[model samples]
Target chain A: MTFDWGFVGEAMPDLLTGLRYTVQATVLGYAVALVVGLLVAIVRRGAPPLVAGTVHWVMEFIRCTPLLVQLFFVFYVLPGVGIELSPLTAGVIGLGLHYAAYTAEVYRSGMEGVPRGQWEATRALSLPAHRVWLAVILPQAIRRVIPALGNYLIAMFKDTPLLFAITVPELLFEANQLGGQYFKYLETMTVVGLLFVVVSVPSAIAIRLLERRYAAV
Target chain B: MNFFVDALPLYLNGARYTLLITVGGCALAFAIAMAVGILGSTRSAALRALASVYVEVFRGVAALVLMFWLFYAMPLLTGYRLEPVFAAILALGLNIGAYGAENVRGAIKAVPRSQYEATVALNLSWTQRMRLVVLPQAWAQMLPTFGNLVIELMKGSAVVSLIAVSDITFVAQQLRTFTGETVLAFAAALVTYFVIAQVFVALMRLAERSANRRLGRIPARPRRRAKPAGAAAKGGAA
Candidate 1:
C-alpha cells in the first residue's frame, strides 16, 4: 500500500549483485550468440541441400519455442542424455542458443544483402573462399548488422530473468528470493522492474536511433 | 514412448488452453495496441507521451516479470485474488501489446504522405481518412509483423506455466514432474510450438492475400522473406 525506502535501501546491495550476474550472463550469452549465429548463417549459406534445409528447419524450431521451455529443457532434459551443466552454464547456453536463432536470421539477411557484384568481384580477383568470407563479405555484413546485434544484447538482458527457473542468481531471481524471504512482493518486484526499465528504456531509444540511421543508408 | 500415449489427453488439454489464451490475449492486445498506436501517432504531444510511457514500461520489462508482478504482487497488494489464466492473459497481452503498439505505429507511419494528401483532396472526414484510406493499406503492412507477434505471443504463452496456468507448457511441466521423463515432455512442447508457428505463418499469408485482393491487386511474391531485415526486434523478437 505504501512505499518503503528503508527496505529498498537494505535490498539494494543484493539486487546490485544480481544485476552484476545479469550483465555477465547477458554479455556471455550474447557473445555466444554472435559467434554461433554468424557461424550458422555462413554454414547454412554454403551447406549442401539437405544440411541447409535441415538447419533452416531447426533454426525455425528454436525460434518458435519459448526460451523458458528451452531453458528447462537444457537444464532438466539434457541430464537424461548424460549431460549436466551448472545453472549459470545452462542459462547462458540456453539464452545463447535461443537468441542465436534470431541473430542467425539477421546475419543471413546481412550476408545476402551484400551486392552480388561483390561476390563476383572476389571471384574475379581470385580470392580464396575463406578470404572472401573473412576479409570481404563478413566485414560488410557485420557492420550492417551491428545495431541489430546490439538490439539483441538488450533483449538478452531483459530475458535473463527467465533463468530464474533454473535458479540462476539473476536480477529477477534475486527479487523473487527476497520476496520469498520477507513475504513482500511490492518492494522487491517494484525495485527489480524499475531496474529493468532503467536499463531497457534508453537502449530501446538507442535502437530506434540506430534504425533511423541505418534506414538512411 | 508409452508415456506419451498416457499423456496424450494432458497434452491435448494443454494445447487447448494454450490456443485459447493466445487467441484471447492477441485479440485484446490488437485492440489495445491499435488504440495506443493511434494515440502515439496523434498530433497531441501529451497523448503521445502517455502512450510512449505505456509502451516503454511494458516493453522494457520481460513478460515473466510482469506475470509475476500481476500474479504474486497484485494479490498481495489489492487482496484481489487473480486467477492464473486471467493473470497470464493480462500480462502476456500487455507485454506483447507494447511491441505491437510500436509496430502498429510504424505501419501507420509507413502509409505514405501521398495517401494522406489524397484523403485531404477527396475531402474525406478524419474517420473516413483513417478507416477507409489509411488503415486498409496499413493493415496490409501490419500483417507480416502481426504474424511475427502472433507467433511470439504463442511462445510467450508458455510463461503462464510459471504461475500454474494449464497451458501446454504448464501441462508439459506437470507431466515431466510426474513421469520424470523430461526429454519427451519438453520435446513434445518444442515440436508443438513449431507446428503452431508454421500454421500461423500460413494463415497470415492468406490474410495478406485477401487484404491485397481487397485493393484489387493480385498477391505477388511473398514479402515475408524480405521482412526480417528491418522488422527484426519489433515485437520482443525473442
Candidate 2:
C-alpha cells in the first residue's frame, strides 16, 4: 500500500530503456504500415476483380482475428517454414501488418473521398496513372486522412506492449520484470500506467482536434 | 490431417472457454458502461468527474498493462489476488466499458433536443422522460457502436491466454508446444476467432434491424439504399 518514491527513482533508468523500445518499434512499425497499407489500398482499388476480391477477403481475415494470435503465428509458427526472425523483427512485422489492414481501409476510403471530377480532369488531360496519383489524387486523399492515420499511430503506440508476449523488452514488459524481481509492483505498474496516460491522453485530444480541423476544411 | 483430427478436442475445448470468457466479459462490460455513461452524462459534476476518471484511466493504458496491474500488482497492494479468469473478465470489462461509455454518452447526447422539450412540455418526471422518450432513442443509437465494442472485447479476451487461461490462443500455443504443428494449431484458432467476429457482426446487424423495425424506420422488409459515400468509420477508436 505504500508508495515507494525511492524505488521509482532508482527504476527510472531501466523504465526509460523500455520506453525507448516502445517508441522505436512504434515508429518503425508505423512506417511499415503506411507503405504497405498504401500499396494494399492501391491494389485493392485498381487490380483485376478476382485479385481485388481475394485481397478484400484476406484483409477481412486479418481484421477479424486477434493481433495476439497473429503475433504468435509470426513469432512461433513462421520459424517452422524456415522464416525465423528475431523478436523485435517479428514484433514490428506483426504490429505493422496488423495495422496495415486497418490503414489500407483508411486509405481506400480517403481515395474514394477524392472528387470524381478530379479523376475526370486527370483523364481529360490524359495524365499518366502514376502521375495522377502522385500529383493530384494522393495529395488531397492523404491530407483528408492524416487524422485517421494519426489515430492509428497512437493505437500502434499503445499496442507495442503486446510485444512483451513475444519477449520484447518494451515498457510493460519492463514493469513486469521489475515487479517480479523486486516484488514491488505498486511502483512499477503505477509509474508505467501513468507514463502511458501522460503520453496517450494528450495525443488523443490532438487527434480529435485534428479531426475537427479537417472537418472544417 | 491426422494430427488435426487428434487435436480437434483440444481446439474445441479451447474455443468453448474463449466463448465463455467473452460472454462473461461482455455482460460485465455492458453493465459498467451503462452505469458510468449515465452517471457521466448527468448534471452532477462530481459523478461526472469520477466517471470520467474511470474512463480515462481505463482507456489510457493498453489492455495488457491493465490486466497485469490487476493480476500481478493489485494483490501486492491490496492482499487480494484475482483468479486469472476473473482478472481477465474484470480487465476486459473495464477496458471495453470505457469505450462503451463514450458510445452511450454520445448516443444520449445525440438524441433530438425536441424530444427533451416534449418531455418537459408533457411535465414528465425525470425517470419518466428517460424511460418513455430518451432511452429508447438513445438505445437504438447505441446498438452499432456497442456491437463493435463487443467484437473488440472478444478479441481482447485472447490476451488472457498469455496469463495461462487456456483460451483458444493458449490451446494453439500448447498444441504447438506438444506436437510442434505450428500451422495447424494457429490456423484452427484463427478460424474459430473469425467465426466469433462474424457472429458478433451478424447479431449486431440483426439487433440494428429489429430496433429500426420497432422504431418505424422500416415497415417490414429491409431495403438497401446506397449511402452517399462516406467512409465507414467504425467508432470506438480509442
Candidate 3:
C-alpha cells in the first residue's frame, strides 16, 4: 500500500495536544524529581545510620523495580485506600518518584564531587547547616550536576509513555487511542516517534554542551 | 490477602518467568550491542552514519513505545503476528542495543592513543591490534557500564506485562485481580526486583575485581599525542 501523508496531517492536532501533555508531564515530573531527589540526597548524606540506611534501601528498591508496575500500583492501590488522583497526577508522581531515585544518585555524586576542603571552609566560617547547604553546597553541587540531571530529564521524558498503562492522556497513549480509533497505527505512531526525536535532539545537544563547559572549567 | 499467602507457588512461578525474560533479554542485548558498537566504529562514513541514526532513534524513544509498537503496531504494519514473549525480547534487544552501543563506543575511545601507536610499532594488523590490544582494555572498562545496562534491561522487561507476558509484574496484577490483595502483590514485585538488582550489583563488583586482577600487573603508560602530520593525513583520508 502507498503511504498517506494526508492522514498524518489531519491527525496532527490530536497528536499535538498529546505532545503538549507530554511536555507538561515531563516538566512537572522533572521539577518534582529535582526537589525530592535533593531531599533524599541530604537524608542519605547526614541522617542517623538507621534513617540513612532506610533511605538508601528505599532508593535502591525504587531504582530496581519497573516504573510500569509502579504506575499500576499507584493507580489501582491508591484509589482503594481513598487517596484518589487523576491519572495524570498519578503518572506524574510515578515518573517523578522513579526518576528521583536516580537523581538522588546523581546528587550523591555531585556532593562527592564537592571537595572536602569546601566542607571544611564552611565549618570554619560557622555557617548554619541549612544555610551552608543552601548557600554553599547546593550551588556548587547543582552546577556540576547539570548534565546528569539533564540526562534524568531526558529519561523522564522518554518514560512518560508508561503513563499509558494508567490511561494517562499523554502523547503515546493518545497516539495509541488515535490509532485504535482510526486503525491508523502507521501515521500516529510514526509522528509520535518523529516528535520524540525532534524534541530530544536539542536536549541532547544541550547536555553535551553542558558537559563540555563543565569539563573545561 | 489470605489467598495471596496461600497462592505463593503461582507468584513464584511468575518470578521465575521474570528471571527468564531478564536473562534472555540481556543475552540478546549484549550480542546486538557488540555488533552495533563495532559497526558504528567503522571508518566508512555511511556505515557509521547509519549506525549512529539507529542508536539515537532507539535510545531516545521510550522503551514502552517500542514495546507497544512491536506488540501491537508491528502486526498492523507488517501483517505478521508475534507472540508477546518474542515481541518483548525484540523491543528490549533493540532498545538496549542503542544505549549499549554508546557505552561500547565510549569504552573503545577511552583506550589511550599511545597504545594504538605501540600496536602499529609492533607491525600488528588492524584486527590483531583491536583483538590483542584495544578490546581487552575496552572490555574491562565497559564491564561496569554494561552491568548497569543489564540492570536497566531487567527493569525494562517488566513492560512486557502490557502484552500479557506472564512475568512477575503480570503475575502481580493477576494476584491482585483474583485475591484483591493489592499491597501483598505489589510488595512481592518490589522485593523480587530488589533481590534481582542486588544480585546484578554483586556480580558486577566481582567481575570488576577479576578484571582488575587480570590487567593489574601492568601500569598504564602515559597517553602519547598523535603527530600533527599523521593526524592531518588520517583526517584528510576519512
Candidate 4:
C-alpha cells in the first residue's frame, strides 16, 4: 500500500544479482547483434535478387515478430529437434537475433548513405574488394550507424526482463519474486524501473553526442 | 500435429484479440501522437520539456515494463482495475504515443518554415495555422514512419501475453504446453504476425497514395496558372 524502503534495502543483494544478469545479457546480446547485423547488411549488398529478397523478407519478418514469442520458441521448441540451450542462452540468442534484424536495416541505410562516388573511386584505384570494404566502406558506415545501434542496445537493456518468462532471473523477475514473497511491488518495481533509466539515459546521451560528432563530418 | 488441429479454434479466437489490441492501440496512439506532437512543437519551452520527458520515459522504458506497471500498479494505486484488454490498449497507446510524437515533430519541422510564415501573414491564429498549414504536411511526412510504428505496435501487443491476455502468443504458449507442439504453434504465431505486419504496411502505402494525391494537386494547380499568366503578360507587354 505504501513505499517500503526497508524491504527494498533488505532485498538489495538479490536485486544486485539480477542486475548483473541484466547487464551481461544486454552486453553479450548486443555484441552478437552487432556481428550478425553486419553479416546481414553485407549479404544484402551485391546479392542476387532472390537472395536479396529472401534476406529482406526474413529480416523484416524477424523484425516484426515479438521477441517474447521468439524466446519461448527458442527455449522450448528447439529441444524437440535436438538443439539444447540454457534459458539464459536462449534468451540472449532471441534478443540478439530479433534486434539484429533491425540493426541490419540501420547498417544498410548507413552503407547507402556512403556516396556512390566512394565506391567508384575505390574501383578506379584498382583496390582489392576486401580492402575497399574494410578500408573505406565499413568505417564510414559503422561510424554513421553507432547512434542507432546504441539506441538498440539501450532497447535490449530494457528488454532483458522478457527473459523472465523463460525463468531467467533478471531485474524485473527478481523484483516480481521479491514482491510476491513480501507483498511489496511498489518499492521493488519502482527501483527496477529507476535502475533501468539510470543506465539507459546516459548511454542515450552518449549516442546523441556520437551522432552529432560524426554527422558534422 | 493433432495439437495444431485441436487448438485451431482457440488460436483463431486468440487472433481476434491480437487484432483488436493492435488496431485499437494503434488508432488511439495515432490520436495521442498527433496531440503530443502538436503540443511539443508549440513555441513554449515548458510544454516542450514536458513532452520531451514524457516521450523519453515511455520510449526508454520497455513496453513490457510499462504494461506490467499499468496492469499491476495502476489497479493497486487507483483501486479500480482496468480489464486486461483496456490496460493493454492504454499501455500500448501511451508507449507508441511517445515514439510517434517524435516522428510527428520531425515531420512537422520538415515542412518548410516559409509555410508557417505564410499562415502567419494570412492572420491565422496559432491553432488555425497548425490545423490548416501544419497537420496536412506533417501527415504526409509521417506516413512511412507511422507505418513502421504500426508494425512496432503489432509486435508490442505480444507483451500483453504477460498479463495473461489470451492473444495468439498466449494461446500458442498454451497449446505448446498442452501438446508439446512448440514449434508448430510458435511458427504459426510468427507467420500470423508477419502476414498481419505486411498487411498494415500495405495499407499505409495505400494511405500514402491518397495523401499524395491530395497534396500533389495543391502545388501543381497554382504553378500552372501562375506560369501561363506570366508568359501572357510578358508577350503582351513586349
Off by over 4 Å in 2: B219-238
CAPRI quality of model 1: medium
True contacts kept of each: 0.59, 0.57, 0.40, 0.41
Error of 3 at B105 (Å): 0.9
Model 3 chain A: lowest-lDDT 10 consecutive positions? A1-10
TM-score of each: 0.95, 0.94, 0.92, 0.92
Give every prediction's interface RMSD: 3.2, 4.1, 10.9, 16.2
Candidate 1 chain B superposition, TM-score: 0.92
Task: Give the per-residue lDDT digits (tens) of candidate 4, residues A116-193.
Answer: 999999989999978998999999988887777777777788789899899999888998898778877777777787
Q: Single out the weakest 10-residue window by summed lDDT for candidate 1 chain A.
A: A208-217
lDDT (C-alpha, whole model) for all candidates = 0.84, 0.84, 0.78, 0.79
Q: Which pairs clash (backbone N, Cα, C closer than 3 Å) in model 2?
A: none
lDDT tens digits, residue span A122-205, model 1: 999999989999999999888778777778888888889888888999898889988889877888898888899999989878
Residue A180 of candidate 4: its Cα lDDT?
79
Error of 1 at A85 (Å): 0.9
Model 3, range A97-142, lDDT digits (tens) per residue?
8878877877887898899999999999999999989999999998
In the range B133-192, model 2's lDDT, one tens digit per residue, is: 887989878887787777777888899998899989999999889888888889999998
Tens digit per residue, CA lDDT, model 3, B195-229: 88778877876786677668773436522211111
